[model samples]
Target: MNKAMICFLLLLSSPVIAQKQKTVDSKINHVTVFLSRAQIEREVRTQVEAGKTDLIITGLTSQLDQQSIQVAGKGNFIILGITHQQNYLSELNTPRSLRILKDSVEFFQKQLLIEQSQKEILNKEEQMLLSNQKIGGTNQNLTVAELKGMADFYRTRLGEIVIARMKHDDKIKKINERLTKVQQQIQTQNELYTRNTSEIVVSISADAPATVQLDVNYIVANAGWQPLYDLRALNTKAPVQLNYKANVYQSTGEEWKNVKLKLSTANPNQGGLKPELYAWYLDFDQPIYRGLQGKASGVRIKSAAPAMAMDKEEDAMEPPAETTADFVSTVQTSLNTVFDIALPYTVSSSNKPTLVDIRKQELKSDYLYSVAPKLDADAFLMARIVGWEELSLLPGEANVFFEGTFVTKTFIDPNNIKDTLSISLGRDKRIVVKREKLKDFSSRKAIGSKQSDSYAYAISVRNAKTEAIKIIVEDQVPVSQNTQIEVTATELNNANYTQETGKLIWEMTVQPNETRKVVYKFDVKYPKGKIIPAL
Candidate 1:
């Protein structure tokens, strides 16, 4: 036979193996959660028959981004295609531990229902007997012996019913208590107990029987994280300790038990295209609204970045007894930042925030006492932190601690364009401050068609603490918007005055047990016929 004829015969003789279908569970190995979304990585290991196989991986979040599904594997096989779909039948796709908790909850709940029903039946029997208690019936008369026997029977029956009801009630109470405990366990586990989840179907071509390990990863919309911070200061002399952390949450049905957790600052959902300036036209302002200021808005995106991965890797540093910040390593990129946690963490899919330690550092700060006695009677301790540009800090609320006591909560805004980050510690009662209008300088007079008002104020801050402290005093005067209204500073008292804003600031260091005073005087004049705004 010719060569072409021989090839055709050989191809016809070869076997055409059809693809076999199978379902396998995946283990969540790593998760890199962004500010609004998280990328979940799972590994699947299973045995495949010769030829072709279609593996369906169950128990993934149904809210995952379909376009972000990625599958790669290491085996003697070639992956053909990957597809995602909702799995209505995979309600039991949760891990064994979570499944046990759910089962226990169901068991206790059923038991509670049974006990309650028994109690209800006893109540019904007792109510019926009491309502029909007319000896035998309304029309029938009973003998003395019959009456006595009937009374005894009624009493005995009623007593039995009451006892049975109490027993049932006791059982119900215990069952309800057990059920509550089980439900709490479920909540703490954070396992999503919803019916609808997701599954990935992968088609692969294999030549022989072998084991295939597939690494599947996808981005889920239901999981994300936000930044949190703890700023503690022992005293003004030492540096401020900034403890960086994150609040991670997810509702994905799969529990991330002891998985490698990576907190990233890279926002995959961030707009890729740079923003363009729109056209601006300044015409006569139309009457749209009054006293409504225009606000500039921008998008805030949290991002995620990744580092090297391994089965067993030593932490950068051993975690302290209270904090795990030392075990976290920081990774920086041009666009965002990332913190790789070496320790394994179990984060249930309960959608509640699970605190994760990022890192901690000592930040230098300039401390001072601040008081605007006109607005507040107490002095607040302020810390001005500089050189925080390298920290890759996110805008978040911070808990302030002073002298081992929680003072108050403040915010850390990385978007602030200033050179320093200012933090306010709680009010200090030791520094007594008082503001009063000086009656000697306060007066109002009218001259011709104009009115003039002179106002003077005295702010005093007395330090009762044993150590000397520095403080700033502030007061402001009203600025005139109309030409007919004029404002003038009469007595500056060596204070730093901003003419545009009509603000007076006095900064001084007061010795222990000394009282420092700040005095400023201002005058406002306007047309007497035309009423002016408040001064």
Candidate 2:
């Protein structure tokens, strides 16, 4: 074929191109929430022709982080470009609720028009009565009967006009009142509409005729989930039931309906950078010289070493036949733990918190009574659990319950080196504890040029409960840092004593209504004329 003929033939054989822009709407299907942020995932499906086409997804949250937006597809279409734009078009100014209010205002406005017309008619009728005020013409005399009849006619007509005018006035008043209320409602609606920013406009294109499913994901601020726990200890011998939950809250202007929710412990707001330590050194200052005029003169000295930079810092379920159970799936990563809720949930854009059950576990705990006698005479009931790290627990506030009663509130921190989680289940009132100073054994005496001081304390623990209890009493002795002073724990009532921290711990089993006494004596030998603190 010739060149022109070949071009015509190629054009005839080419496929027809149909390029059209289509706006697609998406719904939130999944959300993975962090400590103070969340990842929102929305999906939409549509069909496209065998040419380049634009797919615009609208109605997204305005609190979306533009840099965190990600677009993915599962079809033959390829996303050419994606962008976010906020449009304040007049049509968007009226939300659904406000539209209803406007419709009401229009109805009231029509009533107002009728009321105004009625009022104008009343005014015109009154004016006409005033214009006809002449009772008799200036031409001739009238009979008495005729004059009396004219007066009666004027009285009746004037009375009817006044009554009709009053009714019109009342109707106008009511219409004005209705109008005022609608206006106020509109104002309040407008005030609430300030958060309505334009929707997200995504630019997508397709290559061939196919069904494309696009998934849009973005991070939203002002949304978060916090871990909460209810720790219930029925009895000392029974296992503790730990009901784990999350308080999810958000005000990101997007309501997640029937969406899969996942709570995470990852904090994206805190940047992942370990602060470095810089060497800090001090240099000797050179002596300054005084000037002849009695003025001080000093040379600006620079440090020999570089200056150190200051671093800135669930649910319960019922059993049924052939039932399908739903529970939150716990996933742990290197940095965070996730609780994926299997059931769908609806989370509104209000600041109110929605509590969701994550998981519940019956944990075996060792119950013990602990008392810091030097600080308080009350003994606290404590529970220690091992293998809690596998539970994927986070640091949060926990509510303690014992024997079907509210005990206290405590904090649960999972980051521990001992690998055992310890919780204080409030004070044990049945256990009485007291610490007394033994004055006879504690005295100071002078030996040559040195003073020898002996101090002793006795801790008593009495268990008044029906069952026997194990109590740990903790006290501390003075530890000296100077060579001139000598301190020693002369007598430790069969208790474990640590010389480094001068901590004395007494572990004893006290029978019911039995008192156990622990006595510890410490002697301090220091040079004369020296003061000993906390003696």
**Top-lDDT candidate index:** 1
Extract clashing residue pairs from model 2.
314-357
lDDT of 2 by residue, 1-535 (tens): 6899999999999997765778877878989888888988889888888767777676665677777777778887667777787655422234565678789889988987887788788788878878987767788688999889988987898888788878878887887898899889777655534564645554555565899888788888889988899999998898888888888998776767799878887776764555545445555785444323322322111112122222112125664332011356666555667777767898766546888888777787999999997888789998987767778787899999998989888888777536677878888789998889999998999999999999888888889999999888899988888999999889998888898998888888999999888888989999999987766
- As a whole number from 0 to 100, the lDDT of residue 33 in candidate 1 is 83
What is the Cα-based lDDT of residue 197 in candidate 2? 60
Scanning candidate 2 in windows of ten residues, the lowest lDDT window is: 298-307
- Regions more than 4 Å wrong, model 1: 1-16, 47-50, 95-158, 166-191, 207-211, 275-322, 443-449, 529-533
How badly does each model clash, as a count of residue pairs?
9, 1
lDDT per residue as tens, model 1, 379-406:
9999888888889999899999999999
Residue 438 displacement in candidate 2 (angstroms): 2.0
